[model samples]
Target: MEVLQMEVLQMMTPIEFWRAGFVFWTRAAEAQLEFASRWICAVGLSQRAAQTAAQKATIEALRAASVVPLAPNAISTPVPKRAARKAPRLAASRCRPTAH
Candidate 1:
C-alpha cells in the first residue's frame, strides 16, 4: 500500500492520474463482465451495481487527485485569440497581428 501511494504521488500531474484511472476502470469493467458471464451463480451483486460501484470508486480517486497540491505558481500558456469578425480570414489581413 505504501509503495502504491508513493507511485501515485510520483506521477507529475492530475491529468496523468485521471488517464491511468480511466485505463484501470476499463480493465476492471472488462474483468467484471468476464467473471459474470463465466460464473454460473450470481456473486450476490447486480451487474449494474458492480459497474456503478467501480465508476464511483474511480471518480473518487480522480476527485482526491484533483485536490493534491501542485506547483504554487504554475504558468499556463495563453489561449490563441479567435477571429471575431464574420469576414473571411484570408481577406482580413488588417485583423492579423503584424509580425515583428
Candidate 2:
C-alpha cells in the first residue's frame, strides 16, 4: 500500500494530500465510535442479567429462612387444615411370618 501511496503521492498536489489525510482520520474516528458503542451495549446486557440473577437469589434466600409457602391454596386449604407432613414409622414385627 505504501508503494501505491507513493505513486499516488507524486501525482497529488500539496493541498490535495492534506485533504486526503484529513478524510482518512475522520473515517478512522467514526469506526472507533461505532466499536465503542457496540462494546458498551454488550456490557450493559450482561450487567442487567447479573442484576436479575442476584435479585432472584436474594428473594429465594429470604423465603427459605422464613419457611413461607404462600400460594393460591394459602387462604382456603391451609386455613382450616394445615399442610400434612410425612411421619416416620418404626418396625413392630419381623419380616418373616411366624404363624398363620
Candidate 3:
C-alpha cells in the first residue's frame, strides 16, 4: 500500500497535487461544520431537557408541601438561651505553692 501510494504521488502533476490537497481541506471544513452544528443542537436539547426536569421537580415539591400539614407554633419555635460562662475560682490556699 505504501509503494502504491508513493508511485501514485510521484505520478501526480503539481496541479493534481494541489487539487487533491484543496479537495481534502474542503471536505475537512465541511465535516467540522457538521460536527459543530450537531454539537450545538445537542447542547440546546440538553439544556431544554434540564429546564423541563427542574420545572417538574418544582411542581412536585409544591404538591408535596401542600399535602403535608404544618404543626402549630412550628414556624415560631422559641430558641433556647445559653447561660453565661464564668471563670473557675481557685481558693487562696489551693493556689499557694506547697512547702518543699
Best by TM-score: 3
Candidate 1 lDDT: 0.57
- The Cα RMSD in angstroms, rounded to one decimal, for candidate 1 relative to the true structure is 14.5
> What lDDT does each candidate get?
0.57, 0.57, 0.60
How many Å off is the CA of 44 in candidate 1? Answer: 18
TM-score of each model, in listed order:
0.33, 0.39, 0.42
Tens-digit per-residue lDDT, 1-100, candidate 1: 9999998679748888777776776666556555544442355667677666655454444344454343432323455689797755675756777799
lDDT of 3 by residue, 1-100 (tens): 9999999999999999877875665555555545554565567767556555444443444334443244543434776689989999998878978799
Residue 66, model 2: lDDT of 41
Q: What number of clashing residue pairs does each candidate have, in the order they appear?
A: 0, 0, 0
Which candidate model has the greater TM-score, 2 or 3?
3
The stretch of ten residues in a row with the least summed lDDT in candidate 1 is 68-77
**RMSD in angstroms between candidate 2 and the native structure over all alpha carbons:** 23.0
